[model samples]
Target chain A: MSEPSAPVTLAVDCMGGDHGLSTTLPACARFLQRHPDVKLLLVGQPEAVSAGWSRLKEAAAIPAERVRIVPASEVVSMEDPVEIALRKKKDSSMRVAIAQVKEGQAQAAVSAGNTGALMAIARYVLKTVEGIDRPAIATQMPNAKGAATTVLDLGANVDCTPEHLLQFAIMGSALVSVLKDNPRPSVGLLNIGEEAIKGSETIKKAAELLGAAGERGDINFYGNVEGNDIFKGTTDIVVCDGFVGNVALKASEGLASMIASFLKEEFSRGVFSKVAAVLSYPVLSALKKRLDHRRYNGAALLGLRGLVFKSHGSADALAFGYALESAYDAARHQLLARVEQRIQACVMPSPGAVA
Target chain B: MSEPSAPVTLAVDCMGGDHGLSTTLPACARFLQRHPDVKLLLVGQPEAVSAGWSRLKEAAAIPAERVRIVPASEVVSMEDPVEIALRKKKDSSMRVAIAQVKEGQAQAAVSAGNTGALMAIARYVLKTVEGIDRPAIATQMPNAKGAATTVLDLGANVDCTPEHLLQFAIMGSALVSVLKDNPRPSVGLLNIGEEAIKGSETIKKAAELLGAAGERGDINFYGNVEGNDIFKGTTDIVVCDGFVGNVALKASEGLASMIASFLKEEFSRGVFSKVAAVLSYPVLSALKKRLDHRRYNGAALLGLRGLVFKSHGSADALAFGYALESAYDAARHQLLARVEQRIQACVMPSPGAVA
Candidate 1:
């Protein structure tokens, strides 16, 4: 894409995730086996990685040179993301993995560790891109309309200013360019109502800024969208502060769980219902595949100086494998640098310049 | 409850909801038929109410004296919650019903109108309670644990201060006491993490205030609770700003839809899965019943001078019926007066101190 740069190498935090190396190592090995040209720098405790390596080798032959283990003394727990990232776990596997990206040892980094810790490490070491105040994590959400919509600030900056939200919109638009493949992505500010005048004075002001920005052709702002609009694929990018984004993300997950429970009851009502279920099997399978989180493995932390991706904490081998590929794609696309340059090019005189 | 209060009559907005007056009028008629001592004031266009009333008489022999129709000139459309609530037909059923409560002709009011409009009208007419800065809508969410948990600031106040959140906790506890029969309800602040230091400065300050209040036995405060903690039924009342609460509720609804789609796919996978679906019918149905919004209708507009319930805009007959029943329950229980008394008794330093 950018004059065919050398093959990308990613630092994988092997000790991360719920199951740790038991799932991470095999996934990395499998991913390498599938993409021989790609390289991996596995950062974790040596003994644990070695044990997992042995099991992976015994199960299937792996190219020795394609994967290398970089020993690190600590492993950040699921607890206190900020404290561990800042103080206690300076030499942790996650930190070490991030350091590799900062030092140019690897093109990108991928981790299933504590999200806050990952974010903190990325912000502190790699630093925010020029013209960006805070970085945000943007993930692709499967919509009912058979399209994947990007929702950002999934849990980054809890309290955000209008300027911060505008930055997120720009970064998110850049992401959609690389990921969703839309040249001009349609962005919507997540709000209680679609009306421009709806929500708080802060939101109302943000809406005006977004509208002005859209008119200037800086970012494709589609005005305000509501909670239900997320799954309907109403817009390509949905922006919100981390607090709202986090709650929206979790709430969607909760709603999915509730719906699953409801359907199980509906189809089990009678023998006739059971027959209808069989008749609808193919359609249902397609729908499940569409909704599966495993298919969309990683979320990119945008507005940063480097590429960093966060996989689901409960991610298994297949999901983790996808995360690696995602990181490789982000690195090759030079997403971070592209977004930074675009934002810098559009510097405005007022606080609402980008708005 | 407060010496029976002279048979409090409720004005039901019969033209509201998706099912319209066809469902609303019969439900009100049935409710009045069961409670012979209670009077029903149907507020809508007189002809429509009479038509629906005739149907109720044919279906269940509803007594004529128990119900009366107060003609309204118009019906509020579902399109605009704010605009329609303010500028649209002055004689709309929702407005007239609210007017009845404001005029003291009815002790309380129930509406299945646009949520924003109901809130707007309620605030404009009933006004805020004596020491309450804002009126918040509180809903009873039925958790998987087979208990209803009260989640407040559903959609009334989007932006809230620490003092507002603390007041919500106080008001929510009182509502829970009336609805769930929990004398001293456990109140929790919904946050990203459990630790007191986890959220924004606003949340932290609110947590300190809540801690102080809990120490004095004013309300049972359960420290900080995360989004997942909601369905666990860990606390009797969950307090948050309106934005978070609205997103959480919608997200829960979305997640439920997603999960339902997943299970339908799983059940129709094959013959074996189909058989499992049949076997699990009763258990699944029981679970669905627990999640059904119909049974848990009527979100109370707490911290208000009068008892007002906001039913879901998409609610069907059963949910509207529940709204009527809930409004009746709140009036008969003198819920608002109880809340006022509780706040004055607990939070106020002295009898003459401001609430």
Candidate 2:
């Protein structure tokens, strides 16, 4: 960790997510109280940011020196086209927050806005790490073992070659190693089956790359694993193309929501059931706490030179705070440097790079 | 449905699945007792079939005229290569069972063996429907509303084109119509997002084909749906390439299993929790029964000329019986004829035939 004279700062896009200011400002206030050593550069419309600050001033002991209002004239709506957001919305809160990272005013940026727009803007300003073909969205999924498994390329680069998957595996491993404090975190190539012969040509070729990398001590490759293995926590890191990963993640979220609703409906059925529900409320709540998606809200946009994290657009105050915490952790642990070193060591140079 | 002069017969691959004869024989015996009008032709080695019949005679009341024994010297192990099973294992139980449909000896074939081998053998013996590009695996997923949503191309054809997906939607609609007596079953094109611009070119093209088909009254096409929509019962049928469908299905299975185990673990944590668990036992058991994967056992291999159902490999007697029951229902409803009619009506002539 680097000991700097200046406080580590994080630029947060306050005009993002579902309930923009209501969620982001309160979450930032809570975060500031929790982390005395860190400061926040709240990037959004000046009036809204000032109004939020005044509302939270006394209750949150608004640290005047620790918080700064970075004015942004425009906002990026969730439905904005990536290209339009990149070119037109130059002073949007998402862009301004990312610019803080680019201009060295803040160590990292966090946004709970349009994923496509955020990625496009971040890539345009910060660019990907040197040897990395594309940036991947890495997120934590709570597994059956009560630990989180890191999965990457959730939906950033949809069409990936075997080389890109291999890069994902290495980057995911590095992120996991730093977060979990484990040097040799195992990485699993997400395939249709555990058998070597299964899956598309791309997945098979990716398997070969990961296997060879494992042998060379670049990554602790755990061979091929299926979709079920992701929840089973079969490995520390699960790697796949953005398309498959996105489908799997969304499907999982869908199923989890359905199951939770079903449980709620069943428990409220009758007098006897209601009584049982009341009696078992503690256990149910405990289980709910364990499986809460909010606990795993922050997803790091890996492979970029400047650190950035994406929060769920629908996240509330607590969930948004978790995203800020995640970005703060990444910036504090030198995640970008670790990812760069690992990518440089493992990933083969692109054909363009060779040229 | 055509009223057959004789009893509807189903060919059973006795040497398939994990337990081979042990699981299939008992399941078949149970099925026979439950549905007296249905007969089974047990295909396997003569000695094993005879031994199983003798063992199940008194208990299951083995009807002598209804059951037949077909001797086959070879067995297709789950790990065997599809090509080898197709060529060398011509006399294998799986092949013989499918051949019964080819030779018009049975209305349908049921196998709990290797999927690749079954698809290969069935396609080779029965051939694809004239306009169909490839066969797909259609399975039922129980939803919140206590109805099954039919998802197709589960793992049958890994790589699929727009035309192939269009064919799957037609066939799936026909299957649901016959099974649930719902003529206009809504089919959703699975994608990363519900937006038109999201997903790959292949999915985009498939969506266009489905939309056109829906306009022509060939099938009911719902717009794009995310993963969660599968369990939400958003549509009657969810169509995608084999790879995405397979991943979604397996991941959901893994999650369901994990959630069950977690519930059990939490409820048994302490004395107070254990008492609460006992009180909530009925509700828990009801939930378990509702979400039971065993209840949704059979997966029909669709788009072939003749009817075939693939049972889960590790299914026990009860689960295997469910598979047999599914095949019997399909035969009774004439699912194959319905599928063929739908495909012929919607699908364009194959290039081979057109030329």
Best by DockQ: 2
How accurate locally is residue A243 in candidate 2, as Cα lDDT from 0 to 100?
Answer: 80
B1-355 per-residue lDDT for model 2 (tens digits): 4455556899999999889999999999889999879989999999989997888967877669989998888999888888889999989999999999999999999999888889889999999887877888999887777677789878877667888888889889989988888989999998875121378788888889999888888889997887877888999999988888888888888888888999899898889889889889888898788778778888998888899999988899899999998899899888899888877787453462354
Kindly list the per-residue Cα lDDT of model 1 for residues B224-333, writing each as its tens digit: 87776577677888999888888777766655555455566667778877776666566556655776778888989987778888888788777787888888888888
CAPRI-style class, candidate 2? medium
lDDT of 1 at A78: 68
Which number leads on TM-score? 2
Chain B structural similarity (TM-score) per candidate: 0.91, 0.96
Error of 1 at A162 (Å): 1.3
**lDDT tens digits, residue span A182-210, model 2:** 89999998877512137888887888888
Q: For each candidate, give its TM-score against the true structure.
A: 0.87, 0.97
> Candidate 2 chain A — worst ten consecutive residues by lDDT sum?
A346-355
